[model samples]
Target: MANISMTETVLQCHPMSEKGFVDAIAVHVDRAEGGRLQIKYTLHGLVDGIDFPEVAQPKRTDELWKDTCFELFCGRADDRSYVEFNFAPSGQWAAYAFTGYREGMTELACAPPQIKCTAGEGIFEMTVTVDLPESLRALDVMAGFSAVIADKHGRTAYWALAHPPGKADFHHKDCFALQLEARSAA
Candidate 1:
């Protein structure tokens, strides 16, 4: 078993028809104990603003936009925790979770602390890193998990290389790297 921690920046594009973007800073810690994995997440950001739609209709642009953001975090399993939040809209928070097993775990799975957001411009950033279990190395597991999450989420998941480890001032600007991390017991 291995324990890992990672910091990732999450960016979600607003509905093509809508304006503004949703950005979040997420921090995650994962501890692999036996067959079950324990994870924790913390997220904070604005839900609606001048860039986002704000109307009072069920299917209006504003409602649709916000709905899209929330639906992104809706998980299909019982052992996951999903949280949707916004700085506006009464300052209240909504949360849901899957507290059990999630089917189909052949090789990879979506890392916990999945994020959803609206659309906008500018460089948004989040950092997710992990404390690896003694038996596993950080490089291999982190890279694999990150690729799997990006594949499953598609455009909803966006990542860019801020800084490559050990390469002084050399970065991959054109390539965006979105990653998810998961583990299995040995």
Candidate 2:
């Protein structure tokens, strides 16, 4: 395996949502020689005010975005198909594949991701490592990192690497601003 490097990025909250107690959300992403993709999200804010469900056994679940959740979207730079992954602080996750922008959604089946989270004082952090689908490993990939944050006061904010003109649509290609070099066997 080659030495993997991580790219750091800061997410911006959508203008439509009020940026309450959250100061900033930062993400670190990297891919290994094979298909392993690792991402870490560090949120700086009034951590206690963020709604967090009790952590349970890690499992594949749906609709994690209803609360505070972290997300990743990735696809081949030359193709329209993409994958969306949702990671919740509660150890539950969901993955779906799309034929195109928000089209043909289907449950994705792959190895389960390893997720870990910790919060203290004013910081909340989560790390997720998963195996990328083989189809995406041989080509350069584009990715979008986003999050849905809900505070104790019932305020919800959408954060992403970039936002489209109309609304906070993570599915829009504009959000896939990060380019990740391909990892193929030499």
Candidate 3:
């Protein structure tokens, strides 16, 4: 078995009625073998209980419409970090990587794949833009893009993607940029 370690940085935007912005940075270390992947992430700048489950829950509101809207927009409460993807060993990629968020509610706005690795440079950079609905914005939606890099022999060299605490105003039709770098296991 081979071990590949990576450093990741993430930025995200949280649109809250009360808190105008919630942005943060996260560092990640990942391990992959036999088509299965495991990741451990540490986040900085997160407010108390800002994970998905806590954010997705509904609060009591005087207005009935407000309460109902929250339920419809945000799904079940979840607290884990949504930052891992597993590619099938058959070499087929999933239409979407991660699951848990509402379907069609969040989408990959822009992802341009630039696959070029220079000699002695283990970094391959790609950019992906995630567009999230207003309700899902509080999930810090920008950290959902991640991929595993494999060599010609189908060995995972590294896993890379941007972490959360992304730029604010992510819902303003602006594109969020993500960079991925793959280093050799030499």
- Which candidate tops TM-score? 2
Give the true-structure RMSD of model 1: 13.5
Model 3 segments more than 4 A misplaced: 14-23, 49-186
Give one digit per residue, the lDDT tens place, for model 1 in 20-93.
Answer: 23244243434343212222222233322223223222221222223222211222122232221111111112
Between candidates 1 and 3, the TM-score winner: 3
Least well predicted 10-residue stretch by lDDT in candidate 2 = 177-186
> How high is each candidate's TM-score?
0.25, 0.96, 0.28
Residue-wise C-alpha lDDT for candidate 3, range 2-73, written one tens digit per residue: 544343654332322223112332434232222121223332222232322112222221222211010001
Q: For residues 62-131, write the lDDT of model 2, one tens digit per residue.
A: 9898999999999987899999999999899999999998999999988888899988899999999987
The ten-residue window of minimal lDDT in model 1 covers 143-152
Candidate 1 Cα errors over 4 Å, as ranges: 14-17, 21-181, 184-186
For each candidate, what is the lDDT?
0.26, 0.89, 0.25
Query: Per-residue lDDT for 158 in model 1?
Result: 27
Task: Give the candidate order by descending TM-score.
Answer: 2, 3, 1
lDDT of 3: 0.25
